[model samples]
Target: MSYDTEHVRNPGGAPERITGIPTFTELLANVDLASLYTDIYLSTATTGPELAETADVSKKTAYEYLRKLERAGLVSETGDSDGTRSYEATAFEMTFTVSDVEVSITPELVVVIAHADEFPVIERVLEERGLVTFALAYDLVVAHSEGNVTVRQLATLTDLSSGTAYDIVEAIYEIADLGDDDAGPTTYSPNDVADEPTDLLEELTDE
Candidate 1:
């Protein structure tokens, strides 16, 4: 996966824009497909059989998801010489702005969504709270990890109960391994955005 730093920081900074992305509804509804997409996104390039094995799905299912992803412009064929079709996921950062709030859908969030089955809290949040809330939770978790926000502040801003906010932060902490100093490098972070939710909320509330 490749991303230009300037393009990530400011969506308009890119020379070319990506089209034909799947709708958020389509993305959130297909967890298994999202998992396969994440697997491809994390790798340099991979074949259908390799993805099938990694995601524990049948070859047919893997290929089906890959076709869907290809149609959505998320993955592209790498033209392997061995006659096996390999693919690479497109690196992208899509920001949706509604009123004063912005929600970004990046590879990191995709990983979080893909691992929903492995993380009960993430699944619970997705099933109950919905994708927007989950994205906000992820941002808040990042803010908290960086000491920019507190659990009470998260609850206040998001109207979630303090306990719920704490749980969300903890769950994201484990999922993203924010506490692990040895955790590998990541493409996305709180600093990647021009205005984090905490800052936006602070300005809105005059905090």
Candidate 2:
């Protein structure tokens, strides 16, 4: 899967879209919160009870998390004809720019964060390396999936040991398999960004 370069950079001008770093970080750290958010995100629309059943939590727990998600701008609530309230995930894109490089967190990344407990390597990467590196790792995993980079090159680019890089690759494969119900994982490549420095280009080009 791939995203339009411009759409990913700006997402959209939607007022409901979330772009704050703090909010993104807060959501990323909580597995249950992330799970509830993803269920809404990947669904057409769902209610608190449905979310609780799908996420294997109680109704009260689901509504509580739904409120938190609504407050964070990750999900929006709508009323049903029977006076029941349904929730849907909102459009969101969290992006950070450093110098000339920018990384936007994708929905697939959020799914991975939600299921991080199932993959120790991925969990470790997020816990130790933080969000930026985790985003870069996702890109690197996509590059590897497309045969654009090898594990050794991934290690060089990420500054991770080869063993850890390989583990991440395996973990990503598992995550992608688990996401068969949702949109397949998409990627953004730094190479797609034009006029980057010669040395940076050379590094990408290097064996």
Candidate 3:
């Protein structure tokens, strides 16, 4: 998971230069904090206990973090069960662009941009598929876009159960606003990438 910088020489006897480069300090801080935020973004935790266990933080700390995220407009109360309040991510995305430099970036950083449940696609996905299901749904979306449309084929390609593949397809359809009206069985378009995510780290990317 380490990114090694690759230097590309400018052609035509021009000086080699990079643009919009982020400083080491900015890079470190953005990356460090981005990891923590990404954890929350991609977490499947719907309750304090669940979040604490998943994030490896204390329950109290988990609640505290959730409060912070809530204030930051990243999470909100969804429901309650057995006296425990259930919470879910509110759908937000964060990105830091590093330009004019020898940058080595990973797709992990640009996972998803969900803030305040603003995006309809994101809201629908979180509402229908939940946080954990996003990764599965995203993989299926990509695979389907690449021409694998059958349940059996998608399951075989993703190593998921047939039933699970079906569910992921359903979610992708829901997210993309596709429905029973389509002539064909189902197809995912890359235009819907805004809400489709294959990784749980949350959607983010650099320019």
- Which residue runs does candidate 1 get wrong by more than 4 Å? 1-19, 182-200, 203-207
- Report the C-alpha lDDT of model 1 over 1-207, residue by residue, as the tens digit: 445584364434435654556543456667788788888988899988788887757788877888878877888998885788889998877787766667788878987787777777778777887768888878877877776666666666777776677777776777678956664222234355344455656563363
Whichever of 1 and 2 has more TM-score, that candidate is 1
Query: TM-scores of all models?
Result: 0.72, 0.71, 0.31
* Least accurate 10 contiguous residues by lDDT in model 2: 178-187
* lDDT by residue (tens digit), candidate 3, 110-178: 233222123344445445544344444455455455453445555544565666666556655544444
Listed per candidate, the RMSD to the true structure in angstroms reads: 8.5, 8.6, 15.3
By lDDT rank, best first, the candidates go: 1, 2, 3
lDDT of 1 at 56: 59
Give the TM-score comparing model 3 with the true structure, all chains together.
0.31
Instruction: Output the worst ten-in-a-row residue range by lDDT, candidate 1.
Output: 184-193
CA lDDT, candidate 1, residue 202? 58
For model 2, how does the per-residue alpha-carbon lDDT over 65-141 read when each residue is reduced to its tens digit? 88777877778886675877788888877677866678787767888788877878878988788777888888777
C-alpha lDDT of residue 58 in model 3:
59
